[model samples]
Structures are given as C-alpha cells and as structure tokens.
Target: MSKDFTYTINSIFFDENYRPSDGTRITTNFANLARGESRRENLRNALRMIDSRFNALANWDNIKRDRYSVELEIISVDIDIEGNGQHFPSIEMLKTNIIDHKAHKRIEGIVGNNFSSYVRDYDFSVLLLDHNKDLGAFSVPDGFGDLHGKLFKDFIASDSYQEKFNKSPVICLSVSDNKTYYRSENYHPVLGVEYLPNESSLTEQYFKKMGFEVRYFMPPNSVAPLAFYFFGDLLSDYTNIELIGTISTMETFQKIYRPEIYNANAVAGNHYRPDLKHPDYSLTQIVYDREERSQLAIKQGKFAEEYFIKPYRSVLEHWSENSAL
Candidate 1:
C-alpha cells in the first residue's frame, strides 16, 4: 500500500452579508419569519434548515474509513451595518440574548444549548463572529485571555465539550476580513504538532508505531504555495476518490478545480519554504492523514459541490415514488 499522508482541514462561515465592498444583508426567499413568529424562532428554523442540509450530506454510509470527519461550526449573528457608531452588542450580549430571554432560550435549547451541544455528535464546532472594526468592544470578561479563549472555556468546557466525540478533535473560531478571506496564503497556520519544531517527525513516528502509514510533504517553499501545490497534486493523485479543502470563494474553487481552464496557478503566486536552515530543529514535517483529508476535502468545497449535492439529487428523484405509495 502507498504511504498515507495527513490532511489538515479548516473551514469558515460567512453570514448573509459577507460581500467585501459593503456590509449589507442579502434577502432570501427562504426566510423563516412567519406570522407571529419571534425573531429567535425564525432564526432557529433557519438553523434547522441548515443543520438538515449538513446532516443529509454527511451521512454515515458515505464516510470512508480512510477519511477523517470535521464538521463546519455554524456561526449565528445579526447583520450590522458598517460605519454605525453604535457599539455593536458584545459576545456577552449575544449570549445573554440567547440564554436570558425565555423564548430565545427555548429556541436556542431546541437548536442545542450551546455551540458544542449543537455539534456534539461530530468532532468539533466553532462559533465565529464576523470581523468588524468595533469587535473589540465586545469584550471578554476578566480572567480570560481573549474572546476566543473565554468562549471556548465557558461554552465548550461545559459537559457538552467533554462528551465523547465520535473522534477526538480540536475546534476554534476567528474573525476575518476580505483580504484574509480568499487567499490560501492568508489561511491560518496549522496548529498543534504541525507547527511545533521537531514535532512533525515525532508525530509521524508516533503514528507509525500505532500501525498507520505516514508520509510527510515537506516542500522547499512557503506553506501557502506548498498547500496550493499539494492540493493540486492530491486531486490528481486521487481522481478516483474525491479531494477536498477550503477556499474563500466559489471562483477560487473553480480555478483550482480546473487550473488549465482558469490559469489559477499564475495567481497562486510564489512558493516559500519555512526559513529553518537547521535540520534538527523544533519544527517538523507531518503528512496529511486520510481521515483528516476527507474532512478537509468536504469543508474546502469539494464535497460541498460534488458529494453533498448527489444525495439531495437522488432524494429528489425518489420523492415522487415514495409519495405516490
């Protein structure tokens, strides 16, 4: 068997108003606001629709043994107009709105008590707030390092986070702007052992000892360019099996999916290897694991377009057959 590689998977969520030029909410016919429905109720119904779509696409039978699963954490927030002097409500306000009001609490409870609860069955979940200049006003309570840490410690630390996930996983959230959104070069560096010096090699050794095949991809260029090339090579190698990874835009996906047609490689820019001349240093190279790759593939827009759409198409085809019976 060929040596197995490790895949680092990441995902981001954009609200209805995600465009770069202006902060505006896009209207959708799918709005859940029915007569007499509270805003929270409407939000919950919309969330349920999203959850159903995600769950339908992530059916257990479709999960391959070689693939690792990671669920995209759903981020919930109201659209705020840019240049509004009003201090947008803090994360605390958001939480309070969900937890304090009886009706909102009930709506949240139905969705799952917290972010972790909402995604407990999967490996991990993250709740992200869109990046805005006024975000700092949404302060973290004292004694916590930052908003991210506080939310993780408080919400995820509850019983829900401790519950046994189908797989052991890590979760986190971030605020991003337009510049950081589309470019793989701007993607946050992989954390844990992957970034630690001499750690990649050690992790590979550990995995090898555990009876897993491991192959590291240590390109002589920067991580972003390497990532781009790696994905290209990966898709070519696994044409039979679907390949996945995250990108900022559908255009970006189209470019990578068919580089020959789009000339995305030209836009891919330069290759940069980490500046570690010393051989026996702290940083080490780790390969992409199959399971992680599978999850990454889905999150990165691969499965979203291909694997996910197929089941829905099939179900639509069979709907009349079942309904007539």
Candidate 2:
C-alpha cells in the first residue's frame, strides 16, 4: 500500500513586510524588493511551490488517494538574521512572527511544547509531512523568528489535532558537497566523500533512548555525506523510509525494504560551496550531475539493492533492541 506523506515548507524569511536594506538587495534591480508582500502571503506561496514539486515528483496518479494524501502548512518563516552572521532569520524572530501572525490559533490542532521550543536558538525549519494529519506540524529552534511563551500556551490549548501526532518522531536530513570546511579531521578530500553522518544523529539517538524507534541513513555518494535518521514506532503505517540524497544509498535501502521513499537526485555537487564568489561551472552542470547520479542508481538496480537491503534491516533491528526499555 502507498504511504501518505505530508510535506510542509518553512521559509527562512518570516515577515514579508521586512525588507533587506537597499544596498543589500542582490537582484539586478530592486523593484520587487520594494514591493514586498505580507509575510503570510510569501509563506503561503512558498508552501504552494513545495507542494507542487512533491506532486510532480510523486506523480499524482501513482499516489494512492486512499492511503496517501499530501498536506502543506507553514511552521514558521524567519526574516531576521542576527548574532551568528548566518543569513537565515533567528529562531526568536520566527517565534515572534508566529505569535503576531496568530498561526498557533489558526492551526486546527497543536500537539505539545515542541513548537514553542523550536523558536529558541536553533537555526532550522521543519516541515512535517506524513499521511497522518496528527503528525504534520514541526518546529525547528533557529528556523523561526522568536520563541513566545504565551503563544505556545495558547497553541497547546487550541483544538489542533494534538492527539494524532503527539510525540511522532521527526527526522532531519542535511545534504552537502563532499568538499567543505565542515568535514571531519580525517575526511578524504580526493574521494569527495566524507562520513559526516546526518546532523540529527545525536538527536536521533536521544529519541531512541527515550523508547522511540529510530533509523539513520547516510548517502555513500552524498555531496556532503548526507544522513537521514527517523524516529517513531515500528509496525505503523509510516514504515516506508525515504532516503533523499545519494542514488547508491537510495537503491540499496529500497532493495532491502522496498521503501516507498527515494530521492529525486544524488548529492548536489556545489551544495557545500554556496559561498563561492563566482562558481566555475554553470548551475546547469550541478543539476546535470544530480540527474546523472539518479539515472545511474536506476540502471544499477538489483546489484545496488544487494548492498543496502540486509545492512539496513540489521541496523534498524539493532536500534529497536538497543532503544527498548
């Protein structure tokens, strides 16, 4: 049976009203920059784009209407960057935006304090996409604007589908190029491969220790050595895990578990070097490389399956055992 996936898009910018300084505008012309829309509208449009992409990739016809339906929501959008020099907005900013926007009150049902904590100090955004509406809302600490305590209380008190998604395991995936300053000390630059397991590994372990079933996947050919780890109960409808980085890892995992989830491409070559003042290759080159890797995965087929199936299952079983109280 096809599994339902809910995908949400949280923009790094929250307030459409917030505009960059005139000198800081990167576009050739600042016409649109001056006519910025409301933050809510920008966020809604972003979510729509994300939904459209998912629809195209999954092929609406291939999706099982009864078992799979896609839902989109904006957890938060951060527009202000402060302190860390990171261009992304601060978590506090997101929290403030949500409260001001009254999103907590607008959501049908809210689960817990997770959303509140998301706007604290973390620099991430979460889009919870699952067949289960109960499990759709997620917040990342630094992803939003600001954390609002009173707003959180109001949200939890609201009627959102709180029970349905209570404590559902959330997994985060970070994909990057193999060559980057963040690589570990012993990382190999020549192979363009480094074992930088998912940034969420420690978090995944913490969830497992708390009795949630967790699984982590690292794309062997991932540009940044990407990793994906999931946390949740086994034997649930959400059994199919999606690995969206390297083709080799995707094929390997799919062969073993017949996972319904897979990536649209391989590791993004320049993903790690976003700061390059002037890229040597055109953006098209990066896109082509990603496509080639995906095609290769499709061609390799069963052989690729042989590599990932057994090991993947073994690791999952081990995680379950180790995590069980």
Candidate 3:
C-alpha cells in the first residue's frame, strides 16, 4: 500500500447559495429534496415533519407549563484534503456557510451574520482508523491536536461565525469509544457523553487545552453515547437549546426515511455492507429501526430537558411568554 491517498468529502448540509455540493449527492433525502421543481415545498414538508416529531417529544399537554419550538437551518462545510502520510491529520476545512433562505433569521448568539456553520472533515474518520491498522488505537499521530485546535480556533474567530453570534456554537458528535457504553444507574440507552480530557481522555484534553467545552449525549435507547461539545453558554440560549431536540429528531427521521444513510451499526455505513466497487450497492435492512429511533428521541428529549432546559426553566418560560407577545 502507498500509505498516501487523498480525497474530499462534502457535508450533508446545503451551501450558501442553497445548492447541495457534489458530496451531498450520495444521501437520499437531500437528493430527493433537490429533485424536481418543488424543492422548496418539499423542504417545507420535511421541516414540518421534523418540527412535528420534535413537538411530540415535548410535554405539551401540561397546562401549567410552557413549550419551546426549535428552528432548523441547513448549512455547508467543505473539507479539502491534501493527503500527506496520515490523511486524517492533514485534512483542512476550506469553507463553511449557511444556505440562503427566508426562514433563516440571524439569531443573536446562535448563528453568525455571515451565516456560516462549523467546518471540519470527519467523514473519513472511520476510514482513517481502518487504514491505519498498523498503528491501531494509537493511530492519531503527532500534530493532530494542533490541527484540531487550529480548526476550532479559526472557526470561532472567523468573520462568518463572529459577525452575528457573540459566543461559540454547540458541537454535537458521536462518542469515540470502541466498547458499548450505557448509563450505570438505569440501564437505559444514552446517546451523549460529557468528555473531559483528564488522564482518561486525550481527545478531550486536546480540546480542553484549545478552550473548548466537551460533553457527549447518546440518543435514548441507543447502546452507546456520542460526544457533544459546547463552545459557549448553549445551555442558556432558548432557541439554541432546541438544538438537542432538533438533532435527535432529524437523526431518527433519517433512519426511518433514509435507512441507507443511517449510522445503524454506529460505525457509519457498516450496517449497509457497501461494496467499494459498486458505490451504490447497499445491503440495506428491509425493516426500519423505528422502535429504537423513537425510544432514542424520547430519551434524548428528556436528556435535553434535564441538562439544558430544566436548568434554565425560568429563563425559557420568560422567553416563551415574551415571544408570544
């Protein structure tokens, strides 16, 4: 093996001009939405489905309490790869921007005025691990921490991100663990984890040194936890607080509507049994994992409630009441 090959992976999200880049074409939902003359209408319908699913997770029937609604935005993040000896360590984020749309209002402390989202290439993360079998768990080479730090620092300091949002954005990601993790107390499924780079976590330590706050949240009913990083006071932002709910809902939705893209095995496409020669050859499961996904949504929603919503209940209530006016 040459030990050197390079390639670019596009984000699943849309770009500034509201176009799906070359990379987004692999996914079924985005492609279907981009098809035909009714893209906007299709998008609206999809949003409605997502919103409805989110609301279902809320305790709306409670007469004494108020409810919160989440706003969703699709943005682009392009990663250009210049393959070096270790490709994952050399990948660089080139551009990132939110799609142009009427619904996208520049919320203070949420999205920047330049309308950009986070930029980093994690698509090849698994491939990197698989390729570097020689290195095994110690595959993350030197300078990886520096690269990670610079990417986040640049994103936080970027004109696109800093123009509107005064603080950092919340970062949600899957946990980096080979073993299946679960909540010790209840034995229920969790999808997130709070990662502190103490002696236990080198990745967390790298991010902590770079001024990033890391937490992991696993979806409800999931066998393991994913990592979520908070860059600023995301727990206090009413609108942004809906982020947890939004992400959990959309991911569950994908599993149902687009099983081919679902991270079913938690390794991203492992369950699909893709044949490299036949790029489109996916041995997708005939039955959707609706039960697991629904349970995940419920658990994820509750997790958000305790971690984000409940802590700031009074603030959220006040915002809800005021926004009604």
| Candidate 3 lDDT, 1-37, residue by residue in tens | 1112222332333321244444332222333354446
Q: Compute the lDDT for candidate 3.
A: 0.38
Score each candidate by Cα lDDT. Answer: 0.23, 0.27, 0.38
Q: Per lDDT, what order, best first?
A: 3, 2, 1
Q: Which candidate number maximizes lDDT? A: 3
Model 2 CA deviation exceeding 4 Å by range? 1-41, 60-70, 73-162, 173-229, 233-325
**Candidate 2 lDDT tens digits, 248-272:** 2223222211111223233434223
Candidate 1 ranges beyond 4 A from true positions: 1-147, 167-263, 267-270, 273-325
Q: Ten consecutive residues with minimal summed lDDT in candidate 3?
A: 112-121
Output the lDDT of residue 39, model 2: 34
Q: 1 or 3, which is superior by TM-score? A: 3
Tell me model 2's lDDT, rounded to 2 decimals. 0.27
- How many residue pairs collide in each prediction? 20, 30, 18
Give the C-alpha lDDT of model 1: 0.23
Clashes of 2: 30
User: Weakest 10 consecutive residues, lDDT, candidate 2?
Assistant: 91-100
